[model samples]
Target chain A: MSSSEMTSPEETPLLEVRELSISFGGLQALNQVSFAVEEGEIFGLIGPNGAGKTTLFNCVSGLIQATSGVIHYEGQPLDGLPIHARSLVGIARTFQNLNLFHGLTVLENLMVPVEVRQRRGFIADAFRATRSRFGESQAREEAGAILHLLHLGDLRDVMAGELPVGLQRRVELGRAVAQRPRLLLLDEPASGLDGRETAELGALLPRIARQLSVTIVLVDHDMALVMRVCDRICALDFGQVIAMGTPAEVRNDPTVMSAYLGASGAVQVAQR
Target chain B: MRFDRQLLVRAAMVIGAFDVLYLLADHVGANYRRLMTLSAVDGLLVLSLVVLTGFVGQISFVQAELNGFGGLLAGAMIGRLHWSFWVALPLAVVASVAVGIVVGVPALRLRGLILGVVTIALALAFDAWVFSLDTFKAQFIDRPSLLGWDLSDDRATFAFCLAVLAGCAWMVANLQRSKTGRMLASIRDAEVAARTSGVDVTRAKLLAFGISAGLAGLAGVLLDLTIGTADKQSFTLLISLNIAAVVILMGPNRVASAFAGGIFLRWGSEILDKVGVGGKYLNVVLGVGLIVQLIAAPEGVVGQFSHIRAAAGRSLRRRVAAT
Candidate 1:
């Protein structure tokens, strides 16, 4: 329930991306980068464009086949599993670009995962009429609760695409969380959010991580929000890890400063 | 607001009236009833198109080929092997579903133009290589019969077709409401996103295609029985185009569009016949209709209605809030 309670070394790491590497034809996108996210902690993956932030997320979620590496998810090796199987194993992710079903309503979007889970009990849902009625009700209630949590309960009936970019991102996040996963991978969640929206996201991220008992792996460009929300940060440049430490340490790390602010930015980091 | 009991009653009345009219029309003129039966069979085939291309966003011209597969199998069993139509029907459906699964394995990895090209190739290959063979053609030489039921008449075949169409409609509706349906929808909307959400895109696509083909195959068996014959010309690539036309006209979400599309197919042929035109010109008309529908209503007829209803609901809500 609490962040500190989730940090025991003996307990399983929710996700462990070990020496993960990937390539696209002539270029290496990810190179022997390793990181571990503990339960209920907000872990941030930060880098500039082409630093393989999204690629890392893809590999972890099993969208991209790793060139060579192991992804241990909650003590189980996730390397062999496909993306959806990873989801069934309690891993859910939101895309960098909003991927909400534009034609579907927000509630329906949330219901997608629930319906998928219900499919395992398809015979029961179809034949066991009494139990199915209760199951359907419970699924709807959970979807509603998720919508409510994301402050989009009123928009449940509205088309997801009709919502503004900020709300759409929120809905995307909500759908991912609706799966009730142990780990949540968010790819550049702050991409389009304005300063105020970013600040709101900063405040909301930690609250959601705690509320849902989900370990958050946030990849974002908003350094301020990342610094504020993430318990630890991993900085990457050219597919390799530049720095890995607590937010304050990473913010002050000379290597991280150079990765973001260039060679001269190290002085500024030291000054800060 | 009152649960639209009047709408329900009106719908039931119309359906009942049509059924009675169909029965009477069968007695009055068997040919007219035969045409209605044809339309229902065509409607069932079109339902497959609507489900695969419309709902799941997998473009396969092989739907007609799948239908052909059914016809050929039914023909071979009943005509050459002297098997009953009852035995052939389920066998044909299963065979087509197997073929669909085979095609889907490779086809699922392809998208858009590539997918279209690949499936069209598959359809062409099926026509040229399999159907043209003497061994294959030899199987479809006799009249078909069901369990103690001769399908040589109009009324019996019409009832059978109607039942098939109803089953296809129910199955599609159930699928669309199921998790697999949502997964296919997600893949259609955004594959990458769906993949991240833990959806097996390959499996979803295969299932969609398999179900679509199975429905088409079932419809085809019914068609072969109704016509009392299986001809290569009837199961040509043009049938695929016609199926696509129906899907374009009716859209993806509504099963009723299948029937609407079938009626259009029948009317197009009839109007062409009356106007001294031929089946060749029907293609031209269908092509134009497809282009127009894509431009005017990419979501198809049902989509347009839903859009309008949604807009109306929004306006009504705004007005209520203002009050």
Candidate 2:
């Protein structure tokens, strides 16, 4: 179902998850997770390892189905949709592990999502695709624009696999943005970057959010970057939300502090 | 959609280059000319494999058999039913495409050795099925006249087949530059990522299969046209294996590379004979070559050429900068 057919855009958040829970075999991964992201907000999801942060992102993106609960995008339920289908509903995601199409050129990597979104059909692609017929495809122009936005115009012809990790991360982000998603889910955008690269990414993320007018839900281990840029932050521990509020509130919350530092020893650290 | 001047110039250049080659083809002896014709036809079959195996990362050993369907069906239509060549051509293509899609259904769920086995089974079935049809037995077929010109002459038929191969090459190259081109390339690398990127993985695979099969079918029809018969021996599982080997050996990267591979596979033995080293030892040498190819150049010979060219270009650029 389309967002236009939804009940009301104003009434519903861009993304809403209610009591989301999942498990692999018997191990409880996510339990009663709930949150709502407002339109055009830079939302951060932070948790320690095994806290089901990636699992939660997977559930929302349609790679992993939650055992129970609902995921709504612009008031439309996205729980039953496939991963690719979620992209059509304006939800695009970057992987915690970079999944760029390495065989393709940098420009072609960005063009892939744009082409997939805009392609008519196989027959059209073979005989009448505007690019083949006219020599300059709209996909190229769109991809070129993304390269410019990502400041990757110089490396457009380079193979994606040959690029540096920081540049590759940026290319992956560029690819996700090329989908023109309204609700972008970034799984550790700062994962493999150096301090300088992380700082550059931190600066770029908010610009992407404001310029594209997109609602972003970024999950990362980098606490400083999340704290600096996020409008709101949600902390998860053992698949349960310990705190959800403005970045200051979540960071200062005692439960979040205890969850990260351990309840018994954390108080002692504070005492000292 | 403005008409591009560079595109037109490129098109002219491609055609001009082919015509020059075609003129040289007119001078070769009948045997070599005929062998090259078969090579071009084989190249078409190899081209199909490139799309499936190289681009989509699917294996098929039935490409030659698919070509046989075009050859034998069109052959039977013209030879037994007395239908016109032009009329049977399109019907044969569609029928082979249908067969391709049917074969592709199993491929959707199967991959690697299982997929390879499935294709081998299909190829064997095709051989047996064609052998059972009495009317489909080896029969003389005539090439049709195009635009009031008779194609009964060997050189004329060879020229026509080359033209078709060139067209197919152009189409394949064009498809690569299209949106679907990137989709297949993505499918080749990370299929799951392609799916999440909004690529309908199933449809894309089938499209690759169908298109590849269609090209093979066309090549099969051309094979019959060039040889003057719908020979059952041409579409055997052995032929399919050879075509598969050719694609792998050539490293299915470029249309030019595939065409060159086809020439090598089809006429390599003949060329070897001309050089006075043709016998049982040839197969041994080929086995060694294949082993070397796998280890030394997984991308195929064309891949090596491109690598060398790239290295040369880098050095040249460096020298230019120094100057």
lDDT of 2 by residue, A73-106 (tens): 8888886687778877788888888888999999
Q: What is the TM-score of chain B alone in each candidate?
A: 0.85, 0.94
* C-alpha lDDT of candidate 1 relative to the true structure: 0.78
In model 1 chain A, where is the ten-residue run with the lowest total lDDT? A1-10
Which prediction has the highest TM-score against the true structure? Answer: 2
Candidate 1 segments whose C-alpha is farther than 4 A from its true place: A1-9, A120-135, A262-272, B1-24, B138-151, B275-280, B305-323
Please list the C-alpha lDDT of all candidates, in the order they appear: 0.78, 0.83
Clashing pairs in 1: A84-B198
DockQ, candidate 2, vs. native dimer: 0.51
Q: A161-181, model 1: which lDDT tens digit per residue?
A: 899999899999888998889
**Every model's Cα RMSD, please?**
4.2, 4.4
The two-chain DockQ for each candidate, comma-separated, is 0.45, 0.51
